[model samples]
Target: MSTTQPQHRSVIDAITAPRDSRVAFSVEFMPPRDDAAEQRMWDAASTFHDLGAAFASVTYGAGGTTRERTGRIARRLSQHPLTTLVHLTLVEHSAAQLESILKDYASLGLTNLLALRGDPPGDPLGEWVPTEGGLNYAIDLIRLTKSIEECRDFTIGVASFPEGHYRAENLEADTHWTLEKLRAGAEFSITQMFFDVEHFLRLRDRLAAADPVHGVKPVIPGLMPITSLRSARRQVELSGSSLPSSLERRLRSAKTDEHVRAVGIEVTSEMAERLIDEGVEDLHFMTMNFARATQEVLHNLGMAPKWQAAA
Candidate 1:
C-alpha cells in the first residue's frame, strides 16, 4: 500500500481536533538490537508511514538499557513524514539524568513523548526499586517532562491499563491513577494491549464519570494481533492481562501455523471494526518490529492505503 505523503501534523492535533473526523491510527516500535534488526525496523516504519500512520512511537527499554538507540531511532523517525513519539521512563535514571536526557531530546527536535514508570530491569514482575533520585510514579515523570523548558511545546502521552495495571488493587484504583496522570499534564493515553473491547469501554466510562466537568482525555486502545498462541500466552502473562476463553479456543482450534495467523488477522480486524463503530477516536497498534500482520488487519478493515487494494 502507498500514498502521497499527507501534510504534517502532531498526533495530538490529529486526535484532538473537533472538526477532523477521521479516526487516527498510530504504531509502536521497539529499538532494534542489531544491524539486521535495525534495517528491518526501518523497512517496517517506512511501510507503515506509507500506509498512513498518524504517528509512530519507539519504546524505551526496561531499565533504560536502550536509551541511546531509542533516541537515535526516534530522531530519525521525526525526520520522516511521520511524527515520532519517544518513550521516556523512570527506570534506572536519576532525576538529573532524566533531565539531561530530556534536553537531548529537545536538542534533537523531538516533541512527542510517552512517559512511563517502566518495569523492573531484569524481571518485569519482580520488585520495582525506585532510582536514587528519580521519580517514583508516571505522574511525577509527566510533571518532570512538562517542567523542561525545551519541552514547552511537547505533546506528552501516558500509558493506561484497560485491564487495570498489574500492581493496582483494582480497576477503580487503576482509573484513579490514570486520571492523576492526565491531571498532571499528560495530554492523552494509550492503553496496554487488551483482548476485550468491553474492558476498554468500561475504563473509558469510568474515567469520563470521574471528571465530568473537565471530561476525560482521549484514550486510544492498543492492540497486538496474535500470530502464535505461544507468543500470545507469553504476552498476556507479561502484561498480567487475561485472554478471553472464546478467542483462545478458536485460535487453538486452528490446524496449522498459517491458519493461526489467518484467525488472528480476522479476530483483530473484527475488534478494530467494533471499536471504530463504537466511536473510538484512535487505535494504537503494537507492531512488534514487524508490519505484515498489522498491515493485513488494516487492509481487511478497508482502512489500508488505496494502493494496497491495487497490489
Candidate 2:
C-alpha cells in the first residue's frame, strides 16, 4: 500500500530548535520486571517530566513478557502532556494481534510507537517467530502497521544501529536493512546505544551518501551512561556497542557506587555536550530503570528542570 507521510510535527524539529543547535535530548525508559523495579519506572517518568524531555519512550521486554506493563506505562506517561513513544515487537504476533494493539493504543490516546523485531528468547538470539499471523521483522511490522487507518495517527519510529546490528554481516547489510524500514513506512528511528560519537557520525554520513528517498529517517543517537562495571559489560554484550578505554578505566578504578556514578555522569555529560556541539539531531538516554543518574547527567548539562523554563 502507498501511504503518504503523516502530517505530525517531525521529531527533528524538536531536536533542532534554534536555541539548541546541539543534539536534542530524549530518554528511553523501560518497564521494570518486578514491582520494585516498576516503582522505579514511575519515578523515572516523573524525572523525565522534570527534565523537559524532548520525548520519552517505553521498551518491550526480552520476549515481550512485559507487554502489558509496556502498554500501561505508555498510556500513563502519554497522559502527562509530554511526548510518549512505546516500543513494540512483531516476532510473535499475528496481523490480528497487531491490529488489536493498534486499536487499543488509539483508544488510550497514545499516538507514537517504536517498531522493533525485539530480542529473541532462545540460544541463538534473533530466533524470531511469526506467531502464526505476526510479522517476522521490523520492516514487515511497519508495513502491517500502516495498513490500518488508526495507524495514520501513530508516529511510527524504528530502531537503527550505529555499530551495526549484531545479525548484520557488515555495515552495508545494516544500511540496506534500515533503508527497507523507511520504505516500509517508519517515520524516524532511534539507534541502539553507542559510546563512540564517531560511529554515529560515520553512519549518518553513510546514510546521507546513500540518499534514499525517506533518507535514513531521523537517526537519533542512543546514549547510555556507564553506571556500573557489570552494567556496562552487559550492555556491550547485548548491543555490541564498543566501550572506550577511558570509560573502562574509570569503571575499573571505581570503589563505590558513588564513585562509579560520579565518573559516569562526568563522562556521559561530556559526551552529551559534545554530541550537541557536533550537530547531532537528538540524544536518546537509555535508563536501565533508574532516574538519579539520568537526572544527574541532564542537570550537569543545564537541561534539567526543563519545565521551569517552560513555566
Candidate 3:
C-alpha cells in the first residue's frame, strides 16, 4: 500500500478551521486479534469507504504490539480515497525506534497521525514504563514530530479529555497540559469519549482563555455508541468518564442486547444531534470493533448520507 504525498499546511492552518464548520466524519479502529479477524476488519473498513467516510483510523496496541501492522494498514488506507490517521503511542519505543516508525509511515505516504500516551500494559492496575529515549509526554512527542522536515508534513493530532485526564491533579492541570501539546505542534485534537456536552464546552472555553496566542485546535468530540450494560459500565469505571443518570437508568432497565443497543443508539443519537446543532462538523467514533451501531449513530445525526446509511 502506498499513498501520494498530502498537501502541506502549517499546524495552525490544519486545526482552526472556520467556526461552526462541517468537515469530515471518521472512525478509529484497532488491529484485529488474529489473522482471520484482521481480514474481516479490513473488509468492513473497505465497506466504510464505499459508504463515504472522509477517513478511517488504525490503532497501535497497548504495548505497541501492533505498531508495524498499524503502519501497514495506514499505508493501505491512505491509498484509498479517504484520509488515514495512524494512532501512535510514545510509551513503548525508543526515540530512535519511534523515529524509525515515523519514517516508515512517511515512506508509506501517511500524512496524518494521532499522538497518544497509550494505556500501559494491564492498564488501571499496572505501572507504565517509558522506553529508553521515548517521550513521557505527548507534547514532547509533538515537538519531535515537527522537527523532522521529512515527517513534519504530517498532520499530527493529540488526544483531549473533556472530563479531565485520568491522572491529572485537576482539570486545570489537564487544560495546561493540553496547551503545552498544542504549542508543541499538534494540528488538531480528538477527545476521549464523554457522555455530557457541558464537559466539552467548558474545556473548550477554558482552553481558549488560557491560550489566546496559539488558539485551540478543533477538538473533535469522540462519540461511543453504548450497546451493552457490561461494556458501558466497564468503560465508565476504567476511563472515569461519567455516564448520565438517565442513560444509566435506561441501560439498567434494558434486559436484552436489543434493548440495551436501542437505548444506547438513542442516547448517542441525541448527543450527536446536539453537537451538530452546536455547529460541530467533525465527529470521531470509537467503533469498538462493531460497525452497525456506529453506522446507525452517524445516520441519525445526518452525517451519514444515503450511501452510508445503516443497512
Q: What lDDT does each candidate get?
A: 0.82, 0.73, 0.74
Worst 10 residues of 3 by lDDT: 1-10
Model 2 over residues 85-182: C-alpha lDDT tens digits? Answer: 77888655677877898888777766678888777656425554567766778887787778788877577889888888888999998988888887
RMSD for each of the candidates: 2.9, 5.7, 3.5
In model 3, what lDDT does residue 265 have? 90
Candidate 1 backbone collisions, by pair: none
Residues 1-311 of candidate 3 have per-residue lDDT tens digits of 22434433333343334432354567778877767777767666765665555567777875444655665666666566546778888766888877887888788777687888777766753566777777887777777788877798888888889999878899999999888888887867888889898897888788889988644567788888888878888888877788889779888898888999899998988888777777664777888766778778766766554334334
Segments of candidate 1 deviating more than 4 angstroms? 1-9, 16-22, 63-65, 213-215, 305-311
* TM match of model 2 to true structure: 0.86
Which one wins on TM-score?
A: 1
What's the TM-score of every candidate structure?
0.92, 0.86, 0.87
Off by over 4 Å in 2: 1-23, 62-65, 122-126, 305-311
Judged by lDDT, which candidate is best?
A: 1
